[model samples]
Target chain A: MRDILTIEAVEKKATRDGFGQGFHEVAQSNSDVVGLCADLVGSLKMQAFIKEFPERFFQVGIAEANMMGIAAGLAIGGKIPYACTFANFATGRVYDQIRQSIAYSHKNVKICASHAGVTLGEDGATHQILEDIGLMKMLPGFTVINPCDAQQTREAAIAIADHDGPCYLRFGRPGWPMFTETGSFKIGKAIQFSEGSDVSIFATGHLMWHAVEASKKLVQEGITVDLYNFHTIKPLDEEAILESIAKTGCVVTAEEHQRNGGLGDSVAQTIIRHNPVPMEYVAVNDSFGESGKPAQLLTKYGLGIDDVYAAAKRALTRK
Target chain B: MADIAELKRIASQVRRDIIRQVHAVSSGHPGGSLGCTDFMVALYFAVMNHQQSFNMDGANEDVFFLSNGHISPLWYSVLARSGYFPVKELSTFRKLDSRLQGHPATHEGLPGVRVASGSLGQGISVAIGVALSKKLKGDTQTVFVLTGDGELQEGQIWEAALYAPHNKVDNLVVTVDWNGQQIDGANDDVLSLGDLEAKWIAFGWDVMHMNGNDMEEVVNVLNEAKDKTGNGKPICILMKTEMGMGVDFMTGTHAWHGKAPNDELAEKALGQLEETLGDY
Candidate 1:
């Protein structure tokens, strides 16, 4: 999959747009697929789907709790309801609603969240959610997904629609380069970008683009970088993680999320269980993000391309 | 043309089952369960066109949700008497590994319950979702939900209350168990509900009122609520019930809300109500 990183992309799109297109496409094929939004029809990019399937769409006002309960109810009624809202409102605001109605009840509702993490920008700490992945992944029987780019987010949306049970699909607000191949999405399976023996790099969400950029520069410096994209956080691909770590003997995890409960912690838990490896995390260090440009937020939060490069170097030294 | 005598007999047996189940466990909410017994028994036996053999999707048939789920004893008794599960499972209320949890849940594959509800304020939203689903599929069946008057204090209840009528979710009936009592004390003492009837009317629902403890009234009002369905607006029934209705000692107070009666007290409570059906 080296060609995946080599493709110089001229097109850019937000992952939420991919979700909109993918959701609309799936709704066409399956009549059971329904859409529910909490007054974010445009922000979540669900206009086309709402226009085409007005009968299947439900506008639940700004009530996130009701939206979650309705999604669970729709699931009980045998409809695949995609309950859409900002990541903060989707997870934290209505945690009890989700815990009882959807997760504990074992309802098949897809909580499609957008504008996740520091990359949300401008809206600042209250709107930007850094702990969503941890909150959702902690719930029992929830499929947690944080796809890299637009094409992959779209593909993830379509794939999860067919995969039964409750899932949390987290995407972002800002536009990022479209690099991952379309229709190559698989749940709970990591994509190996390149094979090497120096240091293994694990990245998810918007950070994958930066990981790719940092890997190119590292390879030119004669470091063999073993890279993998972890889209699914829960039911993590431990087999792939162990295989890469065994080959490289060290690891660096990158994501536009808090270091506490996001992909970094997931990988650390896996490594501690099977093999103890020297690891470094390139993530927001136990801090709430502020209003800034997406790129500037990444730099301030220690999630830039240079951050990944520096983490990789730190892991190599420990090895 | 309903048998008021027979429904009364069933309600008595359901009340017996509720007391016995809670007494066996030494824990469970018996107050609201006792208070709402007539309404639930009337709904299951005389009101809903439900299948005794339960499925997740209650298509083409009326479905019910108990939003005030601490009263699992009441629902378990009614569901068992209605043949959703064996009547013997009434003995398993709150026991280890039993299908009957302290709160109504689908986790143990309990046939009648569609979702877990112990955390208040979510069940109304869930019922709305099912009602919307039925509307989408052109199914003519109605969705019913019961929440404690105290449960309405939850913000999510108002959120759903605002949503149902605005979206024209007409195939739904929500009945508030207006017992005026919560765990702390009277609702007035804990947190004033402040004119529930006017509140439902102000929220744009087609509101109705009934005495929940009266078996005849419960049956008639539920049938009336069913008749009101398929209109341009959703329906809400503000049901007035005593916190503890039947047993003389437990009645007129909120003290019995979550406490199970001791053996002697259980015997006294059972004496006031006849065992119209054999005990499990």
Candidate 2:
């Protein structure tokens, strides 16, 4: 673990930038690695990979369905295709395409989605996709990954290509906390931020930074908190979750997604089946987001750092 | 050649298997499966140059995808008889824990099935992807996809149609089973696909029409498709096949779209088509 930064310092770096940097780095090593964009190259920060691997990159224009098919086809020809598009377009618009051409075919395709959740900031309900995790996870053999920050997103982009099956890597557009140090990322391994006995805070994607901040706040208020970043949602680190729950009697899940089928529900389901534990979810409570600043939306939707802190306290009180 | 007659005999056996498999399960789309039997038999046996051992990557051999997967009975029979799997596995059609799923899927690890296709109008897009993969790898093998006329109503099919031409996907041969009838009624009744041939031609594809029930016509049109490959345009074969070709009672009827035959009906169907090869 590197130096734990203050919330202000961590908030300076964007996760999409990490994705862009990592994408370009991976393209340098692997010639067969290709990038496909559905007219969202600049927004998703995939222009770096496009610039680095011009011949290998494919600009599919606004046709997301065609982009998915082409990416699947590229995978069939021994090419590792990273398909970049907004979260709304990647999962919701072209779900049938991903289901049949990529997941069902078991193609080695990476669906790297950016601008996930209300954190997309002022893009409104049409751009924000709170149901992407549920949609991607329901697909059999599709690996779903939501990295914490820029560092984790970069690591996930480089690591997902080595994975043989279809993957949905969800990241956000706005700049968030960057806690992880620059290094290689391991998929399906829960990174523990703080070890405590009262309650476990399992967070994913941009919400991990908030969870860490909440954990620090809880510690000062005489509460011992355990925080874990669940980067991979599909092949979830069940052992890590079970181990944390065994130590802490209760759990609190945090994510910038819908409360129904996002990280909270996934963790709750696992805990109930494997190790029954009292759990609370800190997420947008089954509502579509509105146009606003990302920070304001997070606070309004009960997904801010304060919500995670409250959920941790409530979960701890449950035991 | 003697093989041509032998292949026809084998096709008869495959048709018997299709009827038997559908009848045994008491549920399956037999009309289209029976109608496309000769074309499938000719494709797997005479047309595609593949390896004895099946590989999903299909880097060195021709690849085929059944987009309208309701005809899995015919494809499974052809694959089993063609040595992709055991003939005995045909009995487990639609049964629990069987590789022969209601739709063709790779989930059960069934050989020769590259993707899942119970969902209509997704196979051509997948086939295009596979075709694109072949192009990227410098693999000279062609990809063949078969879709139903009714399935062409899906928007994704048009999405794929517009894409194949724009991308110069010349190694793909998409065949539409223009048999007119679907589950509800004729394709014209369900949803009129106005000028389907003209639609493909306008989409910048090299289009050809053939009688799919006739093995010779299928072979000729497919050969023409092969010759037309690598010409900067995808090939579309609008195969005009009957709803049911072999059995007189089931012919030109939408009632048999998914209805299995009773013992008497099965006997009558068997009477029309000879079991040239041994039944499973």
Candidate 3:
């Protein structure tokens, strides 16, 4: 885990900012990259892209399901449409549209959802969506991706344009420090940050930094750890997961999502298939989050670094 | 203008096809399919400017989307009889491994269906998006969408209803099959769709009403809707059609909305509508 720790943050930025930058830059080369928003343009940081490509930007005005249908239509017309909305409205509200029009029909649509999970902060359960990953991953032929930070989110948002199918690209609201440099984002490959022979720490989305911090604290306590970032959640990097589990024998999965059907369950499914491993999850238990500071909510909902550290210790005992 | 007699001939054939196809499967929507036959026949054979050869993007041509997709028998019949595919393929309706899915899906590679539409209220937004695409591309062709009045109860229909006119999607036309019957009962008994034309006008649409069961009227009003396009408003036609227009037993009720006919009833329904074009 020390290799990822050594890759220090250059600056702090939100994953949503990365998405905006990536989409704006991608629109320059691929003229087919049409953008759509349902009255959350500023919240999704799509203003700049809209200004540059005015004709391609469609403001659907508080109608998320219609926005999804419009994007599906555009995709059918040989245009790559990115339907941007809050994570809750993007997945839960328009699931049937996405299922019938995009996923089942296999249209080329990018469902770019921002301000996902509890880190959306102070918006309460209405705005914060902790179950989006679960909702999207269940659909067949959908590539579900939740990037860790700004640089990775930018890479993922741009990379999905070349993929000719429906995808759900998830990002977050709060700005945090960047940990890794960009490039080398394969669709279903896991990145091994650092190698250790004890308990493996698997993390995704904004809580990735928490897992890194957990490894740092665990190193000082002489519990060597292996760390990985599972960004592409649907195509769950099963080979890398089994390889990591082969060495570590146990796991601790951290994500800013519900415990039942988030990244943790994916890892648990993979482990039980290839190699059985005792696993502990650092995720929101079966409950909704209330309005609070992002950091406070992280700590309160058992997604803090200390929680990861404790989960790893617990997993080691099972091993 | 098309030969009204020939259009009526094709409409009769489409009605026969709808009855036979649904009867073959024993589990498809026959009421809406039979009701909307004249409108679809008039549109494909007389109204729209489209090509016989199908492509996915549908660049530089008028496009049609079936928002209420339970009437797959009607769509498949019209699509086949109009040369989008073989008329013989209509016999495969709703069968396993058939391109003609219970709902229209593009993934099945079926011609004339650009988007899937069985889930109600979703197709109008697709039509609007294609209209917007044509506007962006400077393509002059228009887009048409057909929806059921009962399907208007879905909240997404209103969402798409609010979007098309607000964005000035002028190069589009939509027709709602105001048959006043759903799978449950009469539309009034199920849930009243109060003041539907006023609802479309209130939503900023250039609203028109017509008797969709009349082939000549269906052709004329759809073309009139076409002429009204690009005048800075989308058009919505609240077409007044019977629940099952030509079938003696099925007409004026929702009993045959999704239920297929038994063998005896199929022969009886087929007897009412004479086949002007050869059956598949």
Candidate 4:
């Protein structure tokens, strides 16, 4: 396992790039894997697959609902369709289409959403979706995976294709650290980055990078921080959560999503059910993100490295 | 192949099933179900080359999707009478733990139903998807979908309307049940669907027209619509029908769009139609 304190992240790539590459790789292996885009082929990095197999690619043209239904239809027809769009359009805009056609029907469609959370940047609140985790996870039989970094996102794209049934794979826009190694990705399995008996830091998506930074900073300051990457938010690694909290005695959840229904809530629900622990949530506190640089948005929305650090301190104090 | 008379007899039995199913629950959509009976019966019994065994993939056989899923009573009757499920299951319509849900769902393991639908304006896109899958697999079978005239009000329907022709999805045939009545009132009185024929033609579909209630016309137009496929354009049939076609009191108004007929009313409705097939 790579140490969070000294792990080098020399390359920075957007998680969507990993999805595009992974999707292309999966298409190469699985003929049943078809690509459908809501006019965001280039943005979603679906071009490579489209170029390789134009016959299998479908350009749904700005219609997210139709794209969702079509994906469900394709699934029904024995095809594994990756319905690609932004997080905002993928979940909130087409919830009903997904509910009836995909989730309720139990169709094997992969809803791959790019540009998730505040990291979507300048497009602002309209494009950045903070409640997508809640929207997707609430659906029965939905596998919601919010992979951290490019390598994990790529593996997720390929992994979900083999896993039968409906899935919501969320990735982001900005070029974040490509630190997580390949072949380490698994759905519903958490990656424990460091072992400590102080505050356990559970993080997902873009905020996982910040949590790593926060953990390293806390470790330098004589605080033992247990860090785990919660890639799959729906079939949550509850055993890992309970085990970690049992050791650390307190917990802190970090994510670039709403405080109400995102990673924090999932962790809280697990804790409340199992062994209750004093927990702090590092997330957007029920406010829509505004136009700003990706880094500025994170800091402004209380999802920065400092936010995780502060939240860890609060959880530790309560413990 | 069953002649028009036999098809009409099956349709009469289906209408009786629809009325009885809705009347037993007293909380299902009878108006549209009653209205679309002839079309459903003709398609299942006469038009589409489908298997009663019901595989979800529907490979090598024509697959049907009921987009306007509120008419579950109609679809349940057609599926049952055609031997997709036991005809006795019709009595359990809208009851607890029934395969025949208030809306047609695949969740309960309903044999004929491939997709869950009660939310309108989604079936055409789904049909197009299945059609695309058929084309990819080199299967020449057609994909059929039925939508309500009022369902066109949903933006996703138009999105599919734009998509099918642009992609040359020719193996798909979508029929709009232009029943003229919705839950509130007539479509024109509610939200006018002006020039539906012109609209589909402009959307680049091979358009056809038929009276959905007339078994012969329904069978012929559906076959015509199927034959029109694979020529590089999707087909559309603008089917005109009365909302409550068989039951006198249910017809001509949208009042029975979702409301079930009372015991006396159901008996009266059953009195008009001869149970050509034995009642379930």
Where model 3 places Cα greater than 4 Å from the true spot, the runs are none
Q: What is the lDDT of residue B44 in candidate 3?
A: 90
lDDT of 3 at B252: 93
Candidate 2 local Cα displacement, residue A176, angstroms: 1.8
**Fraction of the true interface contacts (Cα pairs closer than 8 Å across chains) found in each model:** 0.87, 0.57, 0.72, 0.89
How far is B192's C-alpha from truth in model 1 (Å)? 1.0
Interface RMSD list for the candidates: 0.5, 1.9, 1.0, 0.4
Question: Candidate 1's chain A scores what TM-score?
Answer: 0.98
**How do all models score by TM-score?**
0.99, 0.95, 0.98, 0.99
Per-candidate clashes come to: 0, 1, 0, 0
At residue A178, candidate 4 shows an lDDT of: 86
Q: Model 1 — interface RMS deviation?
A: 0.5
Model 2 alpha-carbon miss at residue A164, Å: 2.4
Candidate 4, residue A286: the lDDT equals 83
Candidate 1: DockQ?
0.91
DockQ of 4: 0.93
Error of model 3, residue A58, in angstroms: 0.9
- Candidate 1 residue pairs in backbone clash: none
> Which ten-residue region of model 2 chain A has the weakest summed lDDT?
A1-10
Identify the candidate with maximal DockQ.
4
Where does the lowest 10-residue lDDT sum fall in candidate 1 chain A?
A1-10
Docking class of 4: high
